[model samples]
Target: MFRRLRSPGTARALTWAAALVLIAGIVAFVTVRLGQEDKGPANVGSVPTGFASEDFDPNATITEPKESDVPQAARVAAGEFVLAAVGRENLPKAWKLADPGLKRDCACTYKEWLTGNIPVQYFPTKGLRGASFSVDEVTPGHVVLQVLLTPAASSSLKPTAFYIGLKQRGKDAPWLVDYWAPVDVIAVPASPQG
Candidate 1:
């Protein structure tokens, strides 16, 4: 804001106006310095936490921690922060749960190697499907997730299951899906056919 200097009160009116302008400028500067908070995309449930909110208070007592925050953290850990950031076909929420090596190996913007090796059709084009996981018996660093389908694609809408391999990274990494194979798909030959 620009204000014209009022030289030594030739007009008392002009003197008062200049003082008012100066006071207004100071108020404006402080407001600007405080800055505006970022209002992010509309979330269906509620706004997420740990995005560095300015309203956050370091010292605070909770009568009780909100129950909803638990699912919010899991969603961040499993999907949003990790999975939504990678893979070509599906929105890769994979990163949040992915191991560091796989994260690096998958390539930042591409997954050529993975796409080639992965059995894409395990994920059917139609009907309802869900995923679940179980620990591997022999392999310590591996997990097996079973993907179940309902309303079978070929026939009536009964449920079927597909088992897939998920690698456990480090001691703390969430399971990263590495191998996906449909129940009926033929096994890959160990040796090349002549």
Candidate 2:
């Protein structure tokens, strides 16, 4: 015996219900398989392993030799980086001075950087006269400088301040600029003793 639904509405409702059940069943099956995969033997003992031994001292410290030229070199690199970054014509030099972290942060290709499509903000260089920087912090491998850019005498633009971070690969390696940001954008960290 064959019987057709008296109401078209009932048939449409049943169709909708069947589709939902099929989707739910598929979802449940995928979820269960994923769960099993997570707990499978292949995943056993997958915890991260450390190279240090149990007897290794966590407080061990190694001192790096201090280089007399590091401060001067870092300062020179930072200044050059700032100048290069601001000048549209010096984008290639800026790209060379920038470290991997800076490049990654920029999220753009060298070609785009050359076209002045960089992440850094640019000021009117014609209106700016010069930049002066003071070393805020300096380590064996890293240096942070506070830069104050001076505006031209007739220019309406005010002076601007920025923070620049530079790093060196080794004692003899050239310093590279890794970070740059406006002074106001960076938040000061609270004192650990507080």
Candidate 3:
């Protein structure tokens, strides 16, 4: 085989073959990389399709329930959970408020949460000044609310909306946050002046 390759024609052919293989490998690698880039991060999880819309009627009028009708504990839990989750300084507190399913679905460890390596791509917590929530639904064991987070006036971040879900193990048990996801901005209309 060495003697055959030593021939001028055979040597040239081998060099061309090797060059073609390298070129093909490079092309394949670039194609794969570009494909992956287009698709964004592989392990970063997103809220499931139709998950936000389940039982959420955009057309229905949203009224802030009276104080007596509101589940105060659940509302408070949801508020605290949002506040904790948004502020990196309070991640541990947020982690404690999260349900097991949320931790699993978020695919983030306590360390990751601490390091802000969470997969919530659209979490609009920067410069958050206040959060107000309206009860969407409340059952004995579960509560859902639409939380509107307002950023500081000096901040460039716009007010953002999130749907938060909380659940209680028992009547006396503290509410735990099971779901936290950004509401689809498209579904919400802009102010009349805007």
Candidate 4:
């Protein structure tokens, strides 16, 4: 026979504690699932879930233009991001190019892009600033360019570097950013829990 519900006693406290444990377990499960779902190192063709894209080719050979090919502004932007990544740019500088809503998130983004990706995605970071735009498929204000970065040495390896797909909101709605300027990757050495 089932016992009557406890009105007020150790039984009630125990019940509440058990409920909390159950909730914590559920949360932990969901967190683990999401962590596992991340696209292990972005490629040209593949994409992270909850995000969608149609133009990125995981295997396409994309490269930043020569030192003479990159423009003045792009180089500047890349420099700011690099400084921000290396702990030089203050909050305001990092937020210079960041969307208003993403200001607080720029720190992490700056580090990864500056360290592993931007140096390759944008010629400016490669110490090749002021390169002319030889093959700009879309202008900065209207393109979400997805650069497939690969080390020339690892010719056969999958894209080991980051391929940032810029998403600007405006008349273009979401331009595939060919311009290399955004920090799509944030380095979280300890806070990867999220």
The Cα local distance difference test for each model comes to 0.40, 0.69, 0.68, 0.39
Considering every candidate listed, which one attains the maximal TM-score? 2
lDDT of 4 by residue, 76-156 (tens): 554454334222334345445444334333334655533332222222122222212222223334322233333234233
lDDT at 36, model 1: 31
Cα deviation at 124, candidate 4, in Å, is 18
**What ranges in model 3 sit over 4 Å off?**
1-67, 119-127, 185-194
| Candidate 4 lDDT | 0.39
Model 3 lDDT tens row, 51-130: 46456555555443343555778878877776677544477898888888788987877888776555332344546688
Per-residue lDDT tens digits for candidate 2, residues 31-77, read: 97888687553222232122235544445542322334347878778
Candidate 3 vs candidate 4: the TM-score winner is 3
Report the C-alpha displacement of residue 91, candidate 3, in angstroms.
0.8
lDDT of 3: 0.68
Q: Which scores higher on TM-score, 1 or 3?
A: 3
Cα-based RMSD of the predictions, in order?
Answer: 21.2, 15.1, 13.6, 13.2
The estimated TM-scores of all candidates read: 0.33, 0.56, 0.56, 0.27
